[model samples]
Target: MTGARITVDYDAKALDAALSQAVAALDNPIDLMDAIGAVIEEAIDRRFDTASDASGSAWAASLRARQGERGGKTLTDTGRLRASISRAVSGSDVAVGTNVEYAAIHHFGGEIERPARTQVLAFNDAGRFQSRKDSRARRDGVQPIAIATIGATTITMPARPFLEIDTVAEADIADVVQDFLRKSLNT
Candidate 1:
């Protein structure tokens, strides 16, 4: 992938104009999602366009065509959006890490300390069942166990063996974009 950076100076007037346009476009949540998706799609197009010597407008048109081929469905429910964006941006699946741990318990044979640490790998985007794998424990007492992998975006951690495991209930696309922006800016 090309790692070229493009720096365009935005003066106060230009910034104000852009902000005014954005405010004017603000409507509902879905509209916001669509706008954000457009921005993301444009950014991806720009990177490729520069390397290929294609105009920005032409690149955007190509992206729109690609989006249409995929049914022009840019935004969906939070879960679906996560999967879609991950696939679109990375061209690969993305996974979120969830931690699972166990504690000391009283069993039939006196106090029993079960395997102390277990981490459950959960898919960040999908609701369907995926394949699972075992991960190496991060610590001496903690056992790293990952179950169910689905496209690297979603998974389920079985309740068995571990005393407690936390799962992601939702994904925030805005936060994801902010994080991406932060990382991109720093680099």
Candidate 2:
């Protein structure tokens, strides 16, 4: 839980007023925060499943997808990052997201530059070397280079925002507030 997190902070002044009034009427307002946290958690999970952002726009195709890799969803390699998302409710606030080290890079999009520690770096090219130089290699079938060496690199990741309450989620949260207010009045 040391990395980035999505804190539940409403920007709508009207919603803030409504939430304040509604919670003031309740004896235990933390329960309402807990409910809101659950809603956010569900929304984030949905975004992962649909490969969509908080705005409901589809996430940019991952590098693996562009390379013709199959059998896994974007941001879901091994499911560690997705499954790491959780909610923490404290007082009248809730924060939802993951402690994964790479969460911010994938969510916000950025460049990572790795300086060569040694004189050279080595690794298999996995047909990439041939694909770049020879179209024939692509048509015939790429031959995996046993070893390739390079120094330093920059990896760019595109933003795939998944940690905000969108319009739909805002409406849902408003409904939750209204319901809690109604219940408080009833009690």
Q: Find the candidate with the highest TM-score and give its number.
A: 2
Q: Tens digits of per-residue lDDT for model 2 on 1-187?
A: 9989988966698676766666676656788888898889888888888898887799998977567565457887678887988999887688898999999998999999998643322223552334333344446556433333457989888899877667777888999998988876555
Off by over 4 Å in 2: 1-27, 67-70, 117-149
Residue lDDT tens for model 1, 1-187: 4898887886998667656654444322343354344544443333332422122221112233346755432221122322332212222222321121121110011233334343354332344323233332333234433543334232222211111111211123555545544443343
| Candidate 1 Cα deviation (angstroms), residue 66 | 45
> Which residue segments of model 1 deviate by more than 4 Å?
1-10, 33-172, 175-187
Distance from true location, Cα of 89 in model 1, Å? 25
The C-alpha lDDT values of all candidates are 0.33, 0.76
Measured with C-alpha atoms, the lDDT of residue 57 in candidate 2 is 91
Best by lDDT: 2
Candidate 2 shows a clash count of 0
